[model samples]
Target: MVYTISAPPHKKQRITFSSINRAKILTLLPVSLISIYFFGLPALGILLAGILAAVATEYGIQMIFKQDVTIKDGHAAMIGLMLALLTPPEAPLWLPVVGSFIAISIGKHAFGGIGSYIFNPVLVAWVFIRSAWSDPMTPLSIPHIGQFSDLLLEPGAGLLVGVSPIALLAGLYLIYKRYVEWRVPLLFFLTVFFFNQIIAFVSEIVTLVQEGVLNPLLYLATMFTFLELTEELSFAMVGVVIFGIIFLATDSPTTPVTKQGRLIYGVVCGLLVSIYGLFGNYVDGTLYGIFLANGVASFVEARTIPASFSQESVLERSYNRVMEKIPSALKFEVISDD
Candidate 1:
């Protein structure tokens, strides 16, 4: 018997598109179930519609192009699942179906499919649908916590009504240990908090001044009392910002790879979110902010990638630079026996 083996250690890579997508699906499964728990059967229906549409769209596109089928890895399904999470629970049946088609056709296939796309497919669909049909995508007109006067004023209450706390915890864990960089999510939440506190303080200050009671001596105390510590916690804890940072902005192909670049991306995206939430008409601006950040990710990556030496004489310059700092070390001659 003759065996056509090339080498002793003939091993293939353990990582692949299928594995990546599988991990993503598993990670987001809890969040999806949680959403269904809060929103009931309607959420499930929308989710199913999104999945079927995405899969059909990918298969249809492949057929048109006469290319190999690309639906085996669950990439399309993941996109669909993400879209379902982002979409309004009461969205029309055709909304997810159309959004999934556009997400697959234009967001993925237009950029040569999957890894080549410049932005997350679900986010692309979000922008498309939001611009076309504004009302359906917006938050519910009814307040979720109207009875509770303290929590009623939270901006995200309508959108994330009855959202579970575990979803947020799971999302944080997912991003912390995922294959992609963690700084994007970490910095994003941090920046959001920083801005939240700043805005809350400014609002309180403006109110105090308007009421003719702005006290410079007790400004710090006023800031501590009326600032973000208690005001936005409900909004932040509820699903959207945490979910967006972990699952949406942390996309491996779309987000910056370098640590510094990812930091910049996260900060900018978080800043945009704060601006839109506080000033813009929208209660949640993650979709717009992430889409905008994706548009400029390449620019951030170019400037923030760490400096690396060429393969040739890689550490020679480093050794020289170190030796230059120590005159006594330069006097010693080192000879290599090899």
Candidate 2:
């Protein structure tokens, strides 16, 4: 009699690795189609280049290494589509190809594949391409900006996914499906919103002062009376923040494991985005911010884990060792009742 030995996830559930990828693909399909509608053939060409390059690269690497072919799982294709969405519409075809190649070979595979990777592979590839070729990464200006519909449907500036409200709705579905947790994305948005408002308010105050407006107290009183204290916040990159927090920052393997750690990590990512956005470009800042946060995710997870009282923690052990070195008179022992 032969007994088959299998991996630890022996208990079956509806959500499998492949199923998750399929859900992601479905969620992102609308975004891709809308990108084509707005940007036309160039967008189509870029999307194809990224997807094909990622799939082909993953296939070639697996074949050469004589490993099980996992391309059918759709992880490679998802990475490709995501990279393409973040790309500028006018970017050359070769750009996605190169980015996809890097994403598969180095970003995904080099770090021990899929769940073992420490960084979001798409963001890794994007940084590489942007740093190497800054010129082509600049997005083209939209010809006209008139109706509010344009902002929701197509604002042809910054990254392709920057102003896409569809992306936000799709991201919400991912949350509903239980594929992603609500903590990180929620904290990230809250941090960005509050920080941005504070910055804007301070800037407005400075502007008023520069314009020779007298009686600061009167300005404050008028603000309170009219309820005009809060400035209108621009959510130009809300789509980018939503999509990124959902797909990139919350990547199961790379992000924090504990709920508290995830919340802290999200705030850190948002703060970095806000700071970088002030000093540089918003789209670039979002990518870099997430990348930096990924670097510290493991550390955050380690510290956030609740220490067991039954076992001695590292800090406790160290303190005990230090106490042992001190003179007997200097340390008092607690008397335990029998």
Candidate 3:
């Protein structure tokens, strides 16, 4: 038995930069595969162009900064792939390539290289291109998958109507591997439901008021009927929101590390996304939501910081902060024409 003993098993490398990057790639593969399958050559071209440009940008920027190259970590490539996937299928190849460069230079390098970046680099580039060249960046078409419905409520407008098994599986995989915390996503979906209901109820109320009906039960029926009709196709059911929550919003370096802090972060992001989508006329609010969430992470995290002698748990501390700010925020100001 001693002679037949096998060599000691190799120690599993715990979560590291490399593992995190690889997990992200795996999580996104399903989306990429499906896009390429449906969109054919154009999708492939955009994906390749973005990846090539990102790698080139990463290499060039590293040289410029005279920093040790970290392209092998696969982060640049991941960003490139995500950028391509997010771009409109009809977008000029140059758009993705340029976006890839900005993703590398401004989004990554400018923030002190890989792990130090404050926000999701892919989203940073997305916010830039979508703002500057809104035409090309906006999604033009949903690819036709044989008999599969394009799921468009109206041409080039409305929430998606189908659940994406690919995205769902990938997201589940990420959660299973513990690459992302469950609470961030769990709280996110909860807030999305709560927030969406509020928006839906309000919108229905306005419509009923305009149509001249004061019956609450009738209003409830009308609202529920409308919700039932489109519930399967609303923004919450759409693939993009699910995909973004799992992949983009859960970036380790960018999101809060504290367990309770993540809940607040997710809630804020989800609520904002709902507001933007329902009220602000944005096609997809997930992108902007994550960008804004990461930007304001400092404030969210600050509330969860453990006090030296204070008995406050995470929620207590955050609650105190909110209470402390309410008076100042609610203070009235009147301007006099002197």
Candidate 4:
């Protein structure tokens, strides 16, 4: 009797939505829920406007460029909505629409859309909108679920001002799960905290001279160290860190593949965030920092890969070798010794 072994038939792997991608989408739900719970119908309106604007812009651009419409990806629209929600409640309705248009049309689709954008789309929108409408974008006191007078008394009322502890925890979980890069957020927060501490120390010294003793700076610092570091920081800032970890800095098309390059990219982003916080007029420095880092990241990535990999012959040979290994691995043989 003759024995024969045959390899299994080749089957193309179908691309399906991954659990991580689904989890990312689900993560957005919590923030959205919080916004709706606190800010009510207007928040929802802004979110919807931004989403619609982003989708329409994407579709229109694709049609004009003769590219396949990929609006179903849902990433761009979601980003636009999140950005809108992060903005001040008093922000003109047209600003969200315009910002969403800029985010999708220029920040994202112009660069190749979806994963190709170097900066976070939402961050980009935030920067542009804030710059265009500085007054309304700064902050507003609006009615939240439980507080009426607190809204009137506080500086940035109605609008969600401080970071959400719940959202931050969720973000950290995503980082631990490898859904987002841990380095970007960790580095950014540390850098910001350190810079703010230095600023506070100087301010304290100034107050000591004026009043002959330490003033509010010391108290503020203690509070910051205990609470505000994690809570008082703006959600826009948190969003920037989260966006950098999961979206902007991790973008395969815009970011470097090598570990060293990624490290440099993350550090540059951290530094930019610190600088923007200190020098930039916008309270949310994260967006500006991300935009700057994205430019740097793009440059870094272009120089990362070797020229050898770009050659067609080398790539083809490598592809052939990988394909040839599939059949031999499936065969089973037994050896008998006397």
Q: State TM-scores per candidate.
A: 0.78, 0.83, 0.79, 0.65
Any runs in candidate 3 off by more than 4 Å, and if so which?
1-13, 141-168, 209-214, 218-233, 309-338
Cα RMSD, each candidate: 7.3, 5.0, 9.3, 13.0
The candidate scoring highest on TM-score is 2
lDDT of 4 by residue, 13-115 (tens): 4323354455565766666666666677777777778778888988899999999987776665666666676676656678789998998888888777666
Give the lDDT of residue 237 in candidate 1.
44
C-alpha local distance difference test of each model: 0.73, 0.80, 0.73, 0.61
Global fold similarity of model 3 (TM-score):
0.79
Predicted candidate 1 versus true structure: per-residue lDDT over 1-338, tens digit per residue: 99686866554656667877777778777767766776779888988999899999999999999989979999999898878777777788799899999999999999988678998888899789978987988767422222234232333333432244444455555554455568888788788778877777677778878878859338758447533465565444445665677778888778887778899898988888777766653235767888888988988887666667553232465677877888785587888999
lDDT of 3 by residue, 21-57 (tens): 7888876776676666656677788889999999999
In each prediction, how many residue pairs overlap at the backbone (N, C-alpha, C within less than 3 A)? Answer: 0, 0, 0, 2
Q: Which residues of candidate 4, in runs, are more than 4 Å off?
A: 1-21, 141-163, 198-254, 279-282, 300-338
Error of 3 at 8 (Å): 26
| Lowest lDDT block of 10, candidate 1 | 143-152
Off by over 4 Å in 1: 1-14, 141-162, 210-214, 222-228, 281-283, 308-338
Q: For model 3, which pairs clash?
A: none
